[model samples]
Target: MQLTHFNASAKAGVSRASSRRTTVRVQAAAARPSWFPGNKLPEHLDGTLVGDFGFDPLGLGVDKDKLRWYQQAELVHARFAMLGAAGILVPDLFHQIGAGGPAAQIPWYDHAKFEYYAPINALFGVQVLLFAWAELRRLQDIRNPGSVNQDPIFSQYRCVCACV
Candidate 1:
């Protein structure tokens, strides 16, 4: 009933206590931010970037080029939105104060009704053309930085105000 293997091993000087023990050193994992407990902070968004709190929930700006484009698009959209807000407010304010003649009296919502007029339609067409051209130029600028500024058509006008 006695274990002879233990006695035999002990007799041979093969003790478990005498065996070499290996130690594994494991590094501690980085701490996750409190706000994004469920997700890892995007590696691309290092703290060096201005206003970068690593808050890209949708991962839309994963690519740096697309991120730059998105930033530019946001700026353009914001500027247009400001202009649109002013376009609505200025006329409405003028109308409320009985100023700016018959044009201001026409509410912004009703302006679409006058689109059928030849002059308005022409103006709309011109605006659409201008917007399309500007957007193409912006896209070009994004794809090839400084391309827009070098355009012959636009470059000629750059010094138009120099005389003043």
Candidate 2:
């Protein structure tokens, strides 16, 4: 299912439990399941509904215990990468291109223009995804011995570099 859909469902679930809160411990039992407390974030937060607080994958407002150390680090990396990529592209490329001013005069296939920028952005996005997947593989390895394998993305990178 789509991440957004999952998030919505999780949010609905949370709201439903929250709305049933009374002066009883039923709310606690309804909100958090037995297995919900100890499993890794991906096990629980994979379908978590987040709010407007910057891509809340786990719906965790400020509770840092929801995610493990590597997951947290990866989230931080992703946030910074997104900000940096947007910071450069929005102002330097998108804004200029959208404005249709002197920047538009530059050829699309120029050395430092859209040609290189597009490919670099594509590569960066793929690399980021690969890195995140590698982290997931690490988690899997921890769960089951010898579960992780060599990263295919890195192998592809090597092959492409060799060809070039």
Candidate 3:
């Protein structure tokens, strides 16, 4: 037997050579980064899949600025990373609702862990930010005569290790 798949545009199922070609084209397209500058929203999340009542994990309706992954990470760090060290293990209620939607709908706080909680969550994807924060703290602490800065907020923001 042979595998077969639908060719939606043709309104029929395709197999063998034609199917293989379509599959190849699709795979190639998928591999490429589709992001184009000036896009108002992410292609992956267009607010159609989940419907209006549901939440789009990648697409946020309120914020018009479409940011790259790095920009999103930076925004997360600037807004909440230090707070993690300040003892806010869970993100604020507004954050939970805004980025990922209601907790009952999806675990927004859990998802924000990587962005808001640095170093510990660094390995997940925000290593550069964590490294920068750690390095800055290390330099500051060196002159301040403490292993980490004495400031309540800054001290909490210090990385687990000084070496980064």
Best by lDDT: 1
Candidate that beats the other on TM-score, 1 or 3, i.e. the better one: 1
Task: Decide which is better by lDDT, 1 or 3.
Answer: 1
Candidate 2's C-alpha runs over 4 A off are 1-28, 33-72, 92-94, 97-164
| lDDT for position 27 in model 3 | 34
Query: How well does candidate 2 score on lDDT at residue 144?
Result: 64
Clashing pairs in 3: none
Provide the global lDDT of candidate 2 against the true structure: 0.51
> What is the Å distance of residue 40 in model 2 from its true position?
11
Error of 2 at 6 (Å): 48
After superposing candidate 1 on the true structure, give the runs of residues whose Cα lies further than 4 Å from its correct spot.
Answer: 1-39, 48-51, 115-124, 150-164
Return the top candidate by TM-score: 1
Query: Clash number for model 2?
Result: 0
RMSD of 2: 21.3
Q: What is the lDDT of candidate 1?
A: 0.73
